[model samples]
Target chain A: MKRSNRLIVLTQFFLENPHTHTQLPYFVDLCGTTKSSISEDLDIIHDVFEQQGLGMLHRTTGAGGGVRYIPKNADAYDESFILELCEKLKDPERILPGGYLYMSDLLGDPKTVREIGRIFASRFSEIELDAIVTVATKGIPLAYAVASFLQVPVVIARRDPKVTEGSSVSINYVSGSSRRIQTMVLPKRSLKEGSNVCIIDDFMKAGGTITGITNLLAEFDAEVKAIGVFAEADDEDEERKVTNYTSLIKISEVDTKGNQMEIVPGNFK
Target chain B: MKRSNRLIVLTQFFLENPHTHTQLPYFVDLCGTTKSSISEDLDIIHDVFEQQGLGMLHRTTGAGGGVRYIPKNADAYDESFILELCEKLKDPERILPGGYLYMSDLLGDPKTVREIGRIFASRFSEIELDAIVTVATKGIPLAYAVASFLQVPVVIARRDPKVTEGSSVSINYVSGSSRRIQTMVLPKRSLKEGSNVCIIDDFMKAGGTITGITNLLAEFDAEVKAIGVFAEADDEDEERKVTNYTSLIKISEVDTKGNQMEIVPGNFK
Candidate 1:
């Protein structure tokens, strides 16, 4: 393959398997490229990654150590990218029959989710994250993607306990939508005490669920590193409490009455 | 920046924000490049994506369209990659204090989770997944990761009901570990009827929970595309009903007697 082609393939491979331990010999065998070729490709790939300010590719020297891709910056999503994403959030197809945004497709797409993960990973790259926390269901993917980027374990705050979890630490917080007390819980040993945590979720409505997750994290003596959301419902009241946070897309208003919508990038300020 | 560097940065940008609709004017602004330069860079990025077999860089011309990165073969994690990953699964740190393998970290890591998602995505890429299903809470992340890669919405089967979810469809399945009948539920409208579904979870002990998820999927008239697990308990006697599956690691024996263990990749056979 041409050097350019090889560069693209190598970059994709590295991106696909981030933080994975893979020897040069293995790459050589897989790609049918020589060890020297792989080495040279790595150099080019590393240069490309650094030049883009995307992240870094670190190669471990010792036994059982290999190549691991780590993001050099978190919060790397710029204004234009966020704006473009917010525009897509306005798509009518995203609107469910019952006024809910159809986001499962976006959540499932690897490329989309990876990019979303990268945006948050870039933002939180500086902070040492002990865990990625999210409420059960929708928040799970966002939490998983962000945690995957940070290479941290994720703890899901369940709304209710099930036998599968054995035992859990429960917390009660006011639900943002209902303004009533709602409960959430995490597995008893899921998170370590006094750990730094980043809270992430698919959507933030009243910020109640996040507060619930925040309380759950506190119960473990974990510190809040930062908070992020895929989309934040554009409500002035809810936006007040989520002051120090990042949102990929901000839906300012969803006019179900007129079937119209307004969206913008939220609080990257 | 150099032409090569510009292309790399642009590629990273596009990769990070898939399905985003943005014009060349915006790209020019972000990169400080001219419209023509940005256009050229996009071309290079597209070529690189295709040549690498990563996927296609879809561009929509005319009004209200720009670019989208869709994985051509989202399920293309090669067998060699799976084999190599099996080795990493043997890491000592992965072996926990109580003979439990610390898989939450691997499952939580974005890159590892993406790779894990890809492995399953590649396996079930052609299956037309309607939703990725899992029984909360550990399975939520895995289901989300896989569903994200597949670009489908995930319908989480909760071990119990919560008020927020409203009405739900419930099913009873035998818990593999406890060998007890456990009920799992999903919101009534969460999944569409007759949709193809892929079931995923962080770990499987007796395959009972997955079976529960399968039963829940069926309750909505959804079909199972495939079943996947991050880790499967190594014991052989636990008969699993679902045949189409994949697992990154399998814990055959957790030796509490000697604090030793045996870990291997299961049934990618």
Candidate 2:
């Protein structure tokens, strides 16, 4: 294969399998290139990645040293992305009875979800996460997307536990919207003790659901390292159950009577 | 940048944006390489892709011609993947009441979901799907995964319409497992009328949920191009509501009383 072709294949391999370490000799054999030549290629690839602000390619020195790619923070379109998202959230038709905006459209689109996941993954990349946790239903897709880019597995907390999942750990919490006691369950074997988890969800009204997940994680000695939501409601009357959390978009106001809404960017930083 | 580094960047760009067209001049400006050199690089990349069965690159002729990449069917580890998955499903503990298997763990893993998505995308690439459809909860992740690779949006059919989703269309279908009448709903504007959709799910018994989605699509005058699932029960007692569906693994038998189960490969080919 030509040197350029080898570069192309190597680039795809690394990007597809992020956070994986590969020995230099493995690339040497795959590219059929000399050690020195492979080293040079690595240098060029790393430089381009840095210049483009795509991500970082790290080289570990000493024995067992290898190359690993850590995705760069997705800040290139951070401002515009959030602006466009806020615009979408401002649609009056989306407002429901209890001050909620219909976000299924944004959550379902792959392109939209990819950007949201990238932003969340970028923000939380520094924290070592054992798994991305979310409640079942709408949040599953968002959790899966974030987990995919982070190269981690997703752990779903079910509102109703199924018999097929075997023995499970259950918790009771108050639903923010309904203000009713709700049961959340997770299989006992789904997560390991002492592992750090990142809680994610589609929306945050009173933030009751997120608190429930955090409390549930406590049973297994797991800690909630971070919490992320696609959107969060801003209501002066009702205080948020979970205080420390990040959201991509904030709903400042939702007027179902007049069919008007206000939205703004969240604390992505 | 050197031509080799340019090749690496270009490869990443193309792979990231699959099934999209780009003019040769875009590479010429980006890489600062001559048209002939860029063409030669493309040839090399195309050859390597074909040799590895990664995908294909096609060049349209005439005035508005450009190059496009179409991912080939993911066949690198088809046999092993199914064999390993079958092995996992055969675990007796996975069997639940009424002969269902606990597959939430496999379904939640991003890596596992990606492979499954690739297989489905590979099989349905030729169909030209506008959107991937599924019922709420478990199927959302699988649908999102497939839609991401296929570069389309996901349309989730909710079992119960949320007030937040605005107006919706509801349908009645029998639950294959419980043999009870159930309601499924989808937002009125969630999917475009007459759009071709691929129905995906995590599991299928009598395939009632998929049939429900199919019925819902018909209300909008849309067509069901294909249906794919990760697992399906092979019970002879109950007749399948939907025929001509694709599954990755088949559950031959689930002897919950005996604490045993049998699994086999599905119709990948």
Q: Which candidate leads in TM-score? A: 2
lDDT of 2 at A89: 74
DockQ numbers for every candidate?
0.23, 0.70
Index of the highest-DockQ prediction: 2
lDDT of 1 by residue, A127-194 (tens): 87777888767677677777766777777777787554445798888888778888888866578789
B73-142: candidate 2 lDDT, tens digit per residue = 5475676888998888777777766666788888878878987887888788889778899997888888
Error of 2 at A233 (Å): 1.8
Q: What is the lDDT of candidate 2?
A: 0.82
Docking class of 2: medium
Two-chain complex of model 2, DockQ on C-alpha atoms against the true structure: 0.70
For lDDT, the strongest prediction is 2
Q: What is the CAPRI rating of model 1's predicted complex?
A: incorrect
RMSD to truth, every model:
7.6, 2.2
Off by over 4 Å in 2: A91-99, A254-258, B23-36, B74-76, B96-98, B254-258
